[model samples]
Target: MFAALSAIGAFIKIPIGINSAALDTVPALISAAFLPPVYAGAASLIGHLSSSLYAGFPLGPLHLIIAVEMFLILFVFTKLHQAGRNVWKWIFFIVANSVLATLPFYWIISPAFFVMALPGITIATVLNAGIAIVVSPVVERVMERVRTHA
Candidate 1:
């Protein structure tokens, strides 16, 4: 379900860096709020890959590294949510997605590319995470009702 949403988001992208930014992380973050870590991680991985594939894998095999990074980010996001670190989770999610995600490209790609990409990536991260934060509680309530009804 979350994976599907991520894939859907891939098409609605903002071109940035080697790859583009999309609403991919939104579904992953929302899932992280309730589902186990693995589900969120998988959602994030699928999200990134779908977006990359949509863009014809612009970074080639390097996208695997990005996917793994996304997976780890979602994992930590779930952990933070589980631990009740609401503020920290949002901060880490934005920072990890915006800054940390692009930092590696500085060494692997080029410093110039990283510099060029950071602003777009940061903007996309804030938008994506912000949307997730806003809608997650509603989704949680829906899930709660579903579970109770089931």
Candidate 2:
């Protein structure tokens, strides 16, 4: 159910140039928070793929890396409180995906293209992270209720 909702969120996009960050992360984070690691990881991976394909947002294979980033984000963010960790992973992925997602463009286009898209990617990741932080508990609670009712 969370995976399905995350896929549905794929089509509802906020474009950030060559980078991909979307509503999919919300459900992915929720799933991550609730499920075990393997399941959550798979769900997040599927969510990222669905978001890219459904929305046609990322434009190229570079989205594969972005999907990896989404997986990492879901993994690390859900673990944040439980692990009592600092925000360093969050900060790292936000900055890293900008470069990772654009590396192909670097080979095919130019460094200038990667440079141009970096700011938008950074902004999008930050915005998505903020949203994840805000909405995770709501989604988790709703899922728990649904699970118990079922």
Candidate 3:
């Protein structure tokens, strides 16, 4: 249910070159904060692919790359949440995920692929992470209530 809601949150989009800022990151984070890491990854995978496909996502296989990136970041964040750590670490993961994802593409996409896309992707990811941080506590509380009552 929550993952589906998160998927709905992914409907908005702000295209950045080939990649897009579809605002799915926070919902993935919400999934991470409240549910298991696997669910967060699953939500990201499902939400990203589903919405992007439905909207006629143009990046083709690149969408899979971004999905993996989102999954990695949110999955790591779930571990952090379990440890009761600061959410700001998401910034690190965001940047790291971008850097890692931008690899391989260096040879395939373009030699300058990382140089061009890194800045925009990092900015969007960090922004999404910030939004996720702001809403995580509330999500946690709500999920806690649901779990307790369920």
Candidate 4:
């Protein structure tokens, strides 16, 4: 089920070029919401690596960046869930994870990846983060329903 969902998300791209696809963080967020943090992080890592390998991204250092992003996001979500925070708090957490988590990576790799143009990195971060923020509530609600039904 998780793999299928992730595959579907991979194909659903946003119009802008900030690499906003339905695939990137939603699976990670969902896994984090329901599973243990370690499992969620592992799921995220596997899902991303699978997607990248299938889609043909430069997998060298990018894997490290993705691992960091997934771990941070899952850690934040798990902590927030434990703290009994509201949805808005989770949204903020997701946004922070998306931006802050990727910044160091972008900073480190931009010269090699982006030729020193930070705007592309910033734009990608914002768009991906924004999509995650926007999609979070819906995912939460769906999870809630599933939990209730189960």
RMSD of each: 1.8, 3.7, 2.8, 4.0
Task: Please identify model 2 stretches exceeding 4 Å from their true place.
Answer: 15-21, 79-81, 86-93, 96-109, 141-150
Identify the candidate with maximal lDDT.
1
Q: Give the lDDT ranking, best first.
A: 1, 3, 2, 4
TM-score of 3: 0.79
C-alpha TM-scores of all predictions = 0.92, 0.69, 0.79, 0.62
Residue-level lDDT of model 1, residues 1-150, one tens digit each, is: 999999898888876656466887788889887789989999999999998898898789999999999999999999999999999999998899889999999999999989988998898889898899899999989988999999
Lowest lDDT 10-residue stretch of candidate 2 = 81-90
Q: Is candidate 1 or candidate 3 better by TM-score?
A: 1
Weakest lDDT window of 10 consecutive positions for candidate 1: 14-23
Worst 10-residue lDDT window, candidate 3: 87-96
Question: Compared with the true structure, what per-residue lDDT tens digits does model 3 show for residues 66-95?
Answer: 677767766777777778776456655675
**Model 1 lDDT vs. the true structure?**
0.89
